[model samples]
Target: MDEKTGEVLGRVVVTQRVGWCADLVSTMARSLISEHWNTSDVGMLASGEDAEGRALPSNAWMALRRLGWGASAPEGVKVNDRIVRMAQEQAGRTLRSAQWRAELTTGVLTSWPADPAKRTADEWVNVRAAVPGGQHLPSSVIKSRTQQIASFARANGRVPADPFELEGAPGVARMLLLSACDGQQATIECREDDPSRVVLRLQLPVRPDPR
Candidate 1:
């Protein structure tokens, strides 16, 4: 509480449904991707800025590469393939064509090229097929959460991009914390007074923000 204003500050609470730590995995993945892009670009898409100079609409290419994803370029796809394809298909063929190609790449990367409204359980299976892992979370869930955070970044001009930077009551926060967000981290611990009942304790990291 702020003594001067007698107002409460930010607070959050939620149930984990299961002690799966899905949220922790998610936040950490984003942080790793942001950090990877800060110093290096993984050449996942030949159409990206890394070496092949391929244009893409979003930062998802970075995320995919951080996950160690792999894919094969289709036959006949050439240098700057998305951009070239768009220009070849468009009669007017201007700078807007580049935009079209970017959108195309984003769409393909975001979904398994499946319509979102019509996606089913098979999508996760399909993702596992491509991502070199067993099925975990649904592809839609990851995409939607990313979009939610991206929207927050655009509106608030800030988003929590790292969990290692967060600090709170030291061991307490880190031991039980499952999801850390918005300069905050949370953990689930059995209540001391009532060990049978579980409570979520949200905390602000004890460390200073890194600029």
Candidate 2:
């Protein structure tokens, strides 16, 4: 189950319909961890614990627009849904008040369903924000789920390391930019792309060591 990708989940996340379920699950998990959830219906998340036998929350379909969880794509930063879920789950628990950046992100919607009400049926976007009081992402930051990062590193043949101890995307970027070898070197560049956006670039020399 670990090595084989989450097929049903993958289809759900990459598509529109089932994405809200993931968000709800992620949100519920975070709330439990954060001790902020107010509903007694949390048992809905228990394994085989369907109290109402309903697939998910009635408002899940309205998650993005209703909640303003998404914004137009090119106008916003791109992100991965997988990490967004982790961000939600990690939120106030693993992540403290000062852990993430001040700014929050919403999904970058590239396409829309013909029927707005059918939004939950199938949609795609980059993760950027969360529920009213859910986790705020790290600043100038992005976070990746362990599975996503590990799988990519395995295929690429190098595991990154960071001396900065920065968390989320910046941390990953730092690790990737630095070399395991004593003298190996890399270059990183940062610049403002626009009034609201910034760009970060990393250049590393190819190395024989796969660390």
Q: Which segments of model 2 are wrong by more than 4 Å?
A: 1-36, 46-48, 51-78, 88-211
Q: What is the C-alpha RMSD of each candidate to the true structure, in Å?
A: 20.7, 24.2
Per-residue lDDT of model 2, residues 95-133, tens digit only: 222222211211211122243223332331223333122
Model 2 weakest 10-residue run by lDDT? 171-180
CA lDDT, candidate 2, residue 11 = 45
Query: For model 1, how does the per-residue alpha-carbon lDDT over 1-211 read when each residue is reduced to its tens digit?
Result: 4334555544331233212232232233334333333212233332344343445433343324334432222244222322222222121111122333233223323444244334467774554454422255455654663455455556767543431121111111112212212223444678889999996544322222211
lDDT of 2: 0.28
Model 1: lDDT equals 0.34
Predicted model with the maximum TM-score: 1
lDDT of each: 0.34, 0.28
Per-candidate TM-scores read 0.20, 0.17
